[model samples]
Target chain A: MDKVLRDKKAICVFVLPAFLFFFAMVIIPIFMSGYYSLLDWNGMSKGIFVGLRNYIDLFTSYNNEFAKSLGNSLILAGLSVFIQLPISLTLALILARGIKGEKFYRTVYFIPVIISTVVIGQLWSKVYHYEYGIVNMFLRNFGLENLVRDWLGDKGTALICVFIVIVWQYIGYHMLLMYSSAKSIPEDLYEAAKIDGASELTTAFKITIPLMKPILNVCVTYAIVGSLKTFDLIWVLTGGGPLKSTEVPSTLMYNTIFFKNQFGYGSAMALFIVIECLVLTVVVQKIFKSESYL
Target chain B: MKRISKKLLCLFAALSLTLSIGGCKTTDGTDGGTTSPDGGSKDKPTLKIWHITASDAEGNRTILLNAIKEAEEKFNVKIEETGTENEQYKTKIKSAMAGNSGPDIFFTWAAGFSQPFVDGGKVLNLDPYIGAVKDKLLTGITDNFTYDGKVYGVPYQMQVGPLFCNTELFEKYNVKIPETYEELLTAVKVFKENGVTPLICGAKDVWPAMWYYDVLALRTAGSQLCNDALAGKASFESQEFIDAAKKLVELTEAGAFGPNTMSVSWDNANVDFAQGKGAMLFNGNWVTGNVNAESSAVKGKIVARKFPLIEGGKGTATEYFGGAGDGYMINSATKDPKLAADVLFFLCEKLAFDMYEQNTGLPGWNVSVDESKINPLTKEISDMTKDSTGWTLWWDVFLEGAAADTHKNLVVQLMAGEITPEKFGQEMQKLNAK
Candidate 1:
């Protein structure tokens, strides 16, 4: 059986299909996008060969809303990792231990994860509404009407409101990941800690967190990458409106190709997103490696 | 180890199987619903149409469908009707055309938006059909449908942007719906003093905010200037356009637009206007259906009037703001081009006017225009048609390609009061010059 498995033909047969699939689905589209990125194509027109103008304009043009959108994407990524993870980690630590109705609490927390982003976006849009929103209504009922403002429309507050929605929708997902990671640490480590007369906090800080570093790295990497491609919620909620204060790279690419009819520029913007997301992933990996070693 | 490898192999195979089958299933489903005319001698020929009509619009899809049904019976063919939302529909149409899989007949606006399609040879010239139905359409309504001296599509509707006012609110405040710029400002001030919002225009969507600027721009530059600018003959930074921008800025700073106009969305602004929260809304006649839809205090009190004239401006009060509403164009890629054109003419000529009239849409086609056939708002608009000295296209519709997007973003900034009017004009000029 081992001799048969070692056969070259068998190896080729096993790998060929996936290689073909990867080439067709991933490699081809990337190359096509690269090809399309050089032309002044209006999506339907005979594309004019504009060369690097699209990319040059993307980076240098002051009013390229696409660039602003990319900046928003980076901001979203920063908020997700720097802000969301710490809160999710703390919540996971509390929930991971033997607690009342652990299954029920887990189910309740994970429910939001199952809800589609479209539904969440629509629900939150209604909630963030200026005049008739439940949030404003609640504020009025509590006589805190002065505090109520157009949450999604104001340029100062739009991005922050979107960030809050992202955090609310995803904290449970991150918490679940972290909790399972914490649960996987050897029970014997805790028993050994108790024998050493170590306090629970000390045991947790030294043992559990250290052991969960690999999984935490994975979670943070996901958060960063996921934030870079954040589109649906933002599109459905604000549509990068009220002076496009909440524009992000993905939405920018979408609007460029879809609304503005600038496929070439949009493709150039897309390539920038890919490169930025890659750079972010590498930077995060290096930080995680250093943290784990220490 | 052997068992684990076998399980992994099975999992990979199952995943591939599911994906391949899923892809096949989707294609099959799509084909079953939208089989094209080239399905062979044994198959029934099918024609597809893309539209953006709402389902609730009275007699809209039904009228089009009935027309298609009649055409199918006459031509012995099958027809499929699909409707999508505004922006999505345009995106889908563009992508489909790019991929050479566009529907046989698709809806398109009749301006710069259609230029690329016409230039690309993606849309069929409809001059033949236009000539056939020349007597049936309103005079010169077909002119906007012409590109490069060739008619590309039949115009379905002519929308005139008018000031829709709450008559009851005007009566309550003892202020007339202003006919001149100064009177308009005074009326706004009166409304404000009486604790009523004057004009409820939202800049959130950008287009609604543009209406105020369009009227002001028309008043400042007049039709010749606008026509030249739109034709790419004049600079966007001309004194007229700049002065118009400044006037709009002045209006904003003077509280002409009520509190939080920047925050109020298109829907909310319209709803507020319909509810009498504001005295007037400067919008196209297309809004009559929506205004009538609202179960608010000012339901029947809404009345349409021409835009007020500006002080010391060339534009007459009779000059209007509007364009040919979205029209139907045949995809050049369709195999049965004649059938596609037939379907388009059937929809636009036989069905569109009737459906539009019922839904309170102001069709450009020469339909029976008895006052009894239209809503009060539409009748008022129709009456003003004789008074119209000229028409200015919406700024968003005139700026082509990236310049259009740039121009719109500037408008958004202007609406937000982030950029001064001069800055807005300068930025727009830079974009237009590019």
Candidate 2:
């Protein structure tokens, strides 16, 4: 086995396909985007390479909606990791233990994960409807009409409303992952704690929570990366409007490339997105490493 | 076993990487040579036409399908309709053109919207083809299709913006059709006092709110100023333009629009007006078809009139807000340019007039269609265009880049009372600055 491990030729044969694939897909696109980022192309015209102008404009130009969108994406990712993880982890714990109709509840929670983001966005938009929606109707009936303003229309509430929708849709997915990880911890650990005269809460705190740390690190990384790439739900819900207040990086990149025909600039924004995602994933993974969790 | 698992992981990663690279490959090739030449299929001479219409989807796809059917029967060629949502359709057409594999004929707007493609020489010059049947289309609309001494597109319909009024609510408030800006204000005041919201506005989409602002600009500063602004000879921050913005803010402060105007969707606003919840809506001829489909309350009660002129402004009542909607263009790369032109002629000349007869469209083509067949409201909009001093195009239709989105959103902010008129003008000036 040690001789086989030291065999470099075998390693080359095994790794060459993946190396080629990585270069073809991720590495080549990055270089291509960097090249295109210098051009004065509008996705239609013959491109003219002007050298680093798109990047210059993206960073320094006023009314840089792309930069604003990047900021919004970071805010969304931050919120997803901070708020969504803890709540999902708690729900996952409660449901992981012996409970009535656990299978039924699991299915119900998993249903949102199965549904398409477009349908979820559209459904939530109806519920957030200012005038005739069920939420507003109920609010008015209870004389809490002052609190029933346009949730998706107001700049103050638009991003938060979208975040709430994202949480509602993905909480089940995270919960299932955590629940499975929590379940793998031996039940005898809890029995041992009980034999020590520990309460149920104490047993859970000492045994189940500590055991699910590695998987929770993965969950946090997934949540951060996934939230940064959010596009469809935000696009369908707002198209980043009432005044482009709720625009995230993906939608802004989409509008830049597709709507405005600024393909070169859009490519720069996309490259930034890739870099941001990579940097954020590393930071998150490092911050919540398995060693720290242990 | 461990070696096999590692190999499987590499295989999966390789597959994903290949897909990622392949996905962006088509975008890199711009020579329009992606589609392999058909050695055998050339006998059939299939003309691929792209349109943003599907009946099952939203938009006027049903009308486009019937038109396509007529074209197919007349030309003996199979026509495929690739219908998509509005935003998706724009992106698809833009990418298709970029890839050089665009459809033979596609939907386009008349002005600056088509300028990039026209300037790029991606679109075919349809001047001679259109010149053959010059007398068959309406004068202003035919002229609109021409850009820089060459005609590249044909208008399918002429849409004129008019004040769509609720006759029942107007009668309830004892309001007559206002002739001047002052008279309109008086009418609005009367409606407000009578507990009727003067307008059912949906500003969230930004385009609908643009109708109000653009029309106001035309009345306040005249078409000359608008043209100058579009040409970059004049600024949107001028006193006259600022005055127009100020007037719109005044309308909002006076409560001329319904409660929660910012939150209402265009569909909901239309429904509210149809149900007599508001006194009026400022929209184009196309809305007549939408309002007609609503429930009984607004079945026959809606009527349209020319937007009232500002009392002391430069624009006359004859000046209207309008555009040549969805100009049809032929691809220069089409195998059979003549055949593609024939299909467009069919849409512009023959099918268009009949489309009007079916209450499906307002024909921009001059083909003899009796206005008597159209609904009275639509007829008024069609007739007003003939005598109009000038038609104010939508801002997005005229401006390019972030300027279009920025200006439209600024108007929305103005209407929502988020920004003052002066700020609107200044913001636009800032956008227009080098």
Best by DockQ: 1
Residues B1-434, model 1: lDDT tens digits: 98669756755775676578568746754553234446535467877878877475544667666777788787777777788877678787778777767778888887777777888888888766556678877777766768889988776778888888889989987998899888888898898888787888877677788888878889988987887877768776878888888878777777777756655668778778777788888987867876777476676888888788888788887788886756888877676777667666666766646755676677777776455757776777778877777887776776666666777777767767899887877887686566
lDDT of 2: 0.78
TM-score of each: 0.90, 0.89
Q: What fraction of the native interface does candidate 2 get right in terms of contacts? A: 0.42
TM-score per model for chain B alone? 0.89, 0.86
Per-prediction DockQ, in order? 0.40, 0.37
- Model 2 lDDT tens row, B93-161: 888887777878888776767777887789889866666777777776755567787888888777778
Candidate 1 scores an iRMS of 4.3
TM-score of 2: 0.89
After best superposition, candidate 1 residue B335: deviation in angstroms? 2.4
Off by over 4 Å in 2: A1-31, B1-42, B56-63, B66-76, B187-197, B294-296, B430-434
